[model samples]
Target: MHDSIFIKSLFNTLYFVFIGTPFVIAFQLATALILNIEVKGINIFRTLYYLPYLVPMVASVIIWIIIFGHTGVVNQILGLVGLGPFDWIQNVHLIKPVIIAMGMWAAGSGILIFLAGLKGVPTHLYEVAKIDGAGPIKRFIHVTLPMITPTILFSVVMQSIAYFQMFTESYILNKGGPDYASTTYLVNTYNTAFRDFDFGLAMAQSWILFIIILIITLIVMRSSKSWVYYEAGNGR
Candidate 1:
């Protein structure tokens, strides 16, 4: 905690998690809801949504680089708007958001999980809710949401854990450059071990990370009782 670098990286990591995870979760769930509806050739739409996740990280980063790099596609558009270009990768203010956007690209798996959860929601519950005069939003709140709480819990915990260890997106993009603007705790820990060869500090960082993850996961699990509902009445 006394180490300035450690504190900064931890803050950046927390920033990434707190700022990015909820939007990603909501996006995944919303997309899943749309895709779950009975419609023509929905399988094709699912495949398209999942394709970005399947793309190799190197390829994905390269595409983003071309789009966000100085004088790249974004610059081209900005030029049209009478704004020449900003150094996206080198800008301290922008790189984190770019990395967060990269994180958003990997929401395909979460979407699939939510889709499965939606599918598992018993149709009879919706019928009962409709018979009770529940409108669409009320039916969703009263029937679909409660039934899917377990899935939401799973997604939330998993997303939080994943974001806590976020590295590659930052690492590949200039190795968390622009004066460490994008460096996360995991990235810093990695450099401490492999790049700087400070095994002692690296080990300490690892333990700290473990504690953080454990505490957050336990907190979420404990809090699940208020929101999550399981079929067997577990953690109700």
Candidate 2:
């Protein structure tokens, strides 16, 4: 609790969780919604969306580094718009954000899960909703959203924990650099235990992280009772 560095790293970790996770979820849901419909080449589009997740994480992070690098593809495109040649790697303020952005690129796993959930939704439910005068938005809100609450809960919990333990991408990108602005909890834990040889403190720090993640997961799980739907029970 008293380790300021741990506190800072925890904040950075949660920043990634709170900020990055929702967007990733939104992307997954939106992409899944679009891909859920019957359309020619939908399978191809689904495969394309999932390909990024299948790429090795280390390799993908390296690719992202090159793309977001100072004079990399993004900056060149930005140059066309006269916007950015910004130091994405070295800028302290941008370090975590860029790392978070990297997570969004491989959201294929989430998209797949959401797609399954969407496809599993009963077609009869939509028919019933429509019979009650529910339009598209209302059908989605009253039926689709409720039907997918279980999927949403699953994604939220899993993504939160994944983002909380983030280390590799940040470490590889710039070694959590530029004043450790992107030094996530796990990354700092590694440095503290291995680099600083503060095994005791690092072990304690890790336990704290475990407890925090557990609590957060429990909270989400607890809240799901009111929202998550199960067709088998037809009740919460």
Candidate 3:
């Protein structure tokens, strides 16, 4: 029973990270790119985009609960499109995706880090690429992406770590419910320690989770040699 629960929680955590990390990174990078533009009032735009990140986690989850609730604005919008009064939190299949969507809502920190990376990329590189008849897409693929590889690696590692330990959303919104669909490793550990009063078992579970994260992160670091670039050279 314990092993089964452990494996299920582990799978849940990995599924959450695998599915959510891409969207989080994509949204953050897109926002960073947009904010990097030197439009008037750009600072205000940055602040507005970052507002959700500033909200407390419990509060933010509550807000999501309201927004994705049966009568929430999301369903209302869907109704206009002739769909959904869907129970986002209650549906077993949709629960994890809803949680992932919630994670993406607070992508401000990632955006800011990526925006810094974008700023640090040498303008001359883009100019040189343009001179070689590189269009915007090619310049982005060859110049911008390679230059920002470090940032991508950083975001991947950090976001993976964060998602692996995801707790607040499961605890608050789903209560690790709807058939334990949202029960991540941390949530399982929390229940083991607090609900079951099994400190030793919980500690064992935590150590296993730590080892799992360490292994995965090391793998990502090792794999970075193929892609992650530094100012000096490729990461090797």
Candidate 4:
């Protein structure tokens, strides 16, 4: 029984990670790339993009719930477009997309990290690429990507950790209802501990999450030496 419960919780955690991490990473990387370009009012845009990250998690989730509710802004917009009201959080097929959308709203930290990495990339490397007739695409492939691999890996690890603990949105928005569509591992563990008073199982689940995170982090670190480049004379 204990082993079965552990396996179930592990599967749930992995499910959340798989569903969420790609969206977070892709959105952050896109935002970072856009912000890295030379443009007017970039700082203002960056601040706006990052504003959601500053909002408390509970408050953010509440705000999203209001926006995605049946009579909320989203349905209202759909009505304006002559479409019937649709349930967002309550729809099993839409719940994951809704969560991914919400997660994208708080991707500012990752964008900022990537931007910093972009800035630190040696200008001379780009110049060398240009001298060798490398176009923007080539430059990005040979110079930008290799230099930013560390930042990308770091953001992936951090976001994976965050997504593994996702519970607030599901709890506040749908309470993991609609046939357990948004029943993340963290929510399940919380329900087990508080609602069911299964303290021992909760404790075991928590340790399992901790061990999973530790193992993944160690794997990332072990793999980093091969591709993550540090500047010469700077031991990072």
Best by TM-score: 3
**Residue pairs clashing, model 4:** none
lDDT of 4 by residue, 1-236 (tens): 53454455456557668767877887888788898888899899989998999999899989998999999999999999899698888898788788888989977788889889889899999999999999999999999888888788888789889878888877887887666767777888898899889999799888987888899889978888777777673323
lDDT of 3 by residue, 98-159 (tens): 88888788888899999999999999999899899999899889999988999999999999
Model 2 over residues 1-236: C-alpha lDDT tens digits? 33777778888898988898898888789989999999999999999989999999899989988998998998999899889899989998888777777777799999999999998899999999889999999999998998899899999999999998888898889887877788899999999989999999899889999999999999989888888988887558
Candidate 1 lDDT (Cα, 0 to 1): 0.88
Q: Please give, for residues 181-203, the per-residue lDDT of candidate 1 as tens digits.
A: 88889999998999889999899
Stretches of candidate 1 off by over 4 Å are 78-84
Weakest lDDT window of 10 consecutive positions for candidate 3: 227-236
Estimate every model's Cα lDDT from 0 to 1: 0.88, 0.89, 0.90, 0.82
Query: Largest lDDT belongs to which candidate?
Result: 3
TM-score against truth, every candidate: 0.92, 0.95, 0.96, 0.89
The better candidate by TM-score, 3 or 4, is 3
* Each model's total of backbone clashes: 0, 0, 0, 0
Runs in model 4 deviating more than 4 A are 1-12, 82-84, 233-236
Task: State the weakest 10-residue window (summed lDDT) of model 4.
Answer: 1-10
Q: In model 2, where is the ten-residue run with the lowest total lDDT?
A: 1-10
On a 0 to 1 TM-score scale, where does candidate 3 land against the true structure? Answer: 0.96
Query: Using TM-score as the measure, what is the rank order of every candidate, best first?
Result: 3, 2, 1, 4
